[model samples]
Target: MTDQPVTYSADSRLASIWSAAAASWLPPITLILAIVVAWEAAVRIFSISSFIIPAPTEVAKSLVAQWDTLMQATLVTAGEILFGFVVSVVVGIAIALIIVRFDWLGRALYPLVVLFQNVPKVALAPIFILWFGYGLAPKIGLILVIAFFPVTLSMLAGMKSVDHSLLLLMNSVGASRTQILFRILVPHSLPSLMAGTKIAATLSVIGAIVGEFAGASDGLGYIIQFASTQLDTALVFAALLLVSVLGVAFYYAAEILERIVVPWRPKFNDA
Candidate 1:
């Protein structure tokens, strides 16, 4: 009798797990299917020309036809995003640490940071091209500029959120500033850091594409420009899909990293 109840309970738990998984995945899958069907039907029913708007099937064909070229461009753009995002994280953390350590410096430099943050990165692309040329340097520079602010802001918020009593307690124990930063502040700020990273991921992609738009030998943005000029609307759509995938991939990567680094983060399950 005891074994029977235990086995039944285990089965119920497994069923619940499966149900939750399905619930989480079903809505997005259904929405994507609906969009694809509506798009295809609208194009066929309206006698819409493929030049103006390619149907989902037409986009799929272009994706297959130009897979090699698109993949090459994607690889270049991915390298720029990854390299620049990593640099931004490092620089952002350093800036946040400095801000937390010195109140006077943070106050003085924060306005300057915010000022530069508001400057449209695309508007400065020409200057970057003139200065850094058509190489990856300009794209990397743009990505760094666009992505770092959120990280710095998030880290500062997280550190500031730490309890004042904890700080006083540490001071009473003669803990050094460096020790407090590493031992207390860094750990506390990790969740906020990851949240900023997720935001930065999408911005980094935009920055890279905008940089490519100004001047690039090759990238998804370049492909989009060339395809549009050639009236290959399907190809443009195909490139756009790849760009979306890249942005989603980076965002999910940040989410996964957060789960690994902050396993104790709160979860909100539906009632």
Candidate 2:
């Protein structure tokens, strides 16, 4: 007798679909809603002044009212972060490649990387300002320094972690180092690279803001600084809210890109 494939019933299919959807989105959505509700309740229950901690409603109104200026600052900050991040990625990957390919280079230069990474970036802000002379350059340089390490370390580790078996096989087949690196090492390392990129995405914002705090006369950080000095806590909170939204948006954007790039990652299981 021929074996017939067993098919799930329609009810089972519906249940599985709903379960998958819930597993994918329920946790984060619930947590966000809960936090918003709790925040609103706390401000009301304690009779907290807006200056102390603006209500979510107040923040929302401020967001709408200051959308134009806030948005302009956001765009400027985004531009610096994006430009600096891209520069870091390119330079970091190139450095990683050089180190991985040449043991002497790694031994000679990797320690310097460690030294640089160890230095508190904020401490270097004044030096950077002196060197780059305010404007966009200092911010760009700061962001690059902040973002570069993750990419470098992650790429180096990823490149070096290529399977020994694969390398041996390539050697036996007389595959050139370049071919092996391009065909095997890079593909294997993409996940790690993506992880570094995700980290760099967040750090980039911090670096830009810090740089602004040190020198720049524009950007959200400048707004934050000015607001704080004037005791405009609502405006500070408004700028902070903008920064938070930017970080979330940028991180999730990187996450979406990672998923697209790494489609082999397993999805939620509904069974």
Candidate 3:
């Protein structure tokens, strides 16, 4: 009898954890299953040709049959995405810092930075291919351009949003510029930077895939393009599903990393 309360408490804790997890995950899982069922029913009812629109089962079969090729392509695409994302974050943060530190430079150059982003990335891909060849170089180059804008823009906003009064206090304390930057500015801007990372993460995935679509010897995008030409819509759908999963994975990775970096951020109750 003495140990019963402790056992009950442990059981209650386990139950609460499962409840929280289900509350978070169950709706999306249920929704996806519902959509899959509806999709299957619609295809059957209409007798839709697989080439016109693959049934979910057809896509599943394609996924299984092409798993080896798909896995290799996924790895190639993941490398491109990760390389571009890391570089973009570093380059974007550096550029934002430089612009922030040099007030006159920021005024003169920030508009140009914004202007560069307006140029269509698709248009630039060919030029990058010409310059960098058909290797990962061209893909990474394009991804960098496509993904860096949001990080730089968001970081600038966060740094600029810091309280002016706090800057004055730091200035009065004989704090070095480096000290001010890392200790005050960086910390203050972290949340905004993290928000940018999420955007950049997804963009990295998009840019790599799109780059491949434009022209690549490998990667999921290449598979998608080839499948389309052959009218293998099932394979195309499988590739698209893989790309979606990759994007979602990258986005959630950023979200999880943000938690580690900014543990103070609050979590809302799923209930």
lDDT by residue (199-264, candidate 2, tens digit) is 988998899899989987788998899888887777888899889888888888888988998787
**Ten-residue region with minimum lDDT total, candidate 3:** 1-10
lDDT of each residue in 1-271, candidate 1, tens digit only: 4555333477876787789889999999999999999999999999899989999999999999999999999999999989988888888888899888888997888888889989987798889999999999999898888899999999988988999999999999999998999999999998888889888888889989998998998999999988999999999999999999999999888888888988878644422
Residue clash pairs of candidate 3:
none
Q: Which residue pairs show collisions in model 2?
A: none
User: How many times do residue backbones clash in model 1?
Assistant: 0
- Local lDDT at 114 for model 1: 87
Q: Per the 3 Å backbone cut-off, how many clashing residue pairs does candidate 2 have?
A: 0
lDDT scores in order? 0.90, 0.86, 0.90
- After superposition, the stretches of candidate 3 with alpha carbons farther than 4 Å from their true spots are 1-18, 268-271
lDDT of 3 by residue, 95-167 (tens): 8988877789978878988899899987888888888888999898888999999999988888879999998
lDDT of 1: 0.90
